[model samples]
Target: PGPFAVNTATFVGYNLGGFLGAAMATLGVVLPSFLIILIIARFVYNFLEYRTIRAGFEGVKAVVVGLIFAVVLNLLEKNIFGGTLAFKNADFVALGIMLFVLVLKLVFKKKLSAIAIIVISGILGLIFYGMFPL
Candidate 1:
């Protein structure tokens, strides 16, 4: 519980095969994308010059942005608001941490790194919920 971590391919590989496994897993994860990019690099410049392709890429970008916004809203409703359908409860601490980090980022113009925000939020949670027992 000292540091929060994501269980990525390297983590899984290390869990299964130690250092070598982690290296292999990292290579396996990256190699395909590397080779594909290498193969596509020749055509990508010319492809982007086409008006239809450019338009398609713009459409894709818009859809991706919309999907990201939708996901964030859904998570906020379910986790922070405690069920959008029922509206039965709300997690004030979770909401507070979210708003605090959001306001800090906005006020500072994203000068804060993600790690700093996470550590600060974790400490705030411990102080409010663990140590002081709010």
Candidate 2:
């Protein structure tokens, strides 16, 4: 109901039918996934009992983790390392903040919560970038 991804469907629906269209579009997008999950829920417990299925799921989990790691690496390369954007000017401030946060996290070994990291990052951004006259 609240995912940002749903905004695409809602936008299309609004363009087509206004509020009613948006509602319908949202329902159209959500209902199938909801129904699919519901249908799968009945068999999930029994399905998990199979060793092959469990192994397949484990493989899927590994793939998902790898994909997530790849995305993080891609973001770091593009944004922090200034891959393409370096042609214009690399945002050294952002790079510094990223390195600082990465080092802090590595040093602390995630003793910091996500909220704490976000707050610290925001403050660092303010100190480094926001406070400066542009």
Candidate 3:
């Protein structure tokens, strides 16, 4: 989506020169990648049959999961723990909301929709933070 949208916009911007210019701009951006993929697509498929290549891909997947978990921890630290892991600095209201949602998810299974969770969170946010300002 990102490449398609940007490439299309670039083509349109070529109209700053003319329609031909736009067409050239779009093709210039898209052609190289299309050609490269076309050339390498078969080799890539064959390479995937190798054990070492498959293991490398699995390692990449693990790294991606680790990176995602690190991001979640950083956000949790900054938002709920005030950028540090001190127990006293933790926002209990945010923690309570997180726990409540976790419970709902575990206990209810597929009973709750995303909208319902969001609405419940907002109401809880208002009730906890609105009524009692910390």
Which parts of model 3 are misplaced by more than 4 Å?
Answer: 1-12, 83-134
Candidate 1 residue lDDT tens string, 55-114: 999999899869967997887688666644432334655556676776577548967764
Best by lDDT: 2
Q: Which residue window of length 10 is worst by lDDT in model 1?
A: 1-10
lDDT, model 1: 0.72
Note the clash tally of each candidate.
0, 0, 0
- TM-score per candidate, chains pooled: 0.46, 0.51, 0.47
After superposition, candidate 2 runs with Cα above 4 Å error: 1-21, 83-134
Residue 130: error of model 1 in Å? 14
Highest TM-score: give the candidate number.
2
Which candidate would rank higher by TM-score, 2 or 3?
2
lDDT string for model 3 (4-79, tens) is: 7657757676757587777777777778878998999878889999999999989998998699669968876786
At residue 7, candidate 1 shows an lDDT of 39
Comparison by TM-score, 1 against 3, better one:
3
Cα lDDT over the full model 2: 0.77
Looking at candidate 3, the ten consecutive residues that score lowest on lDDT are 84-93
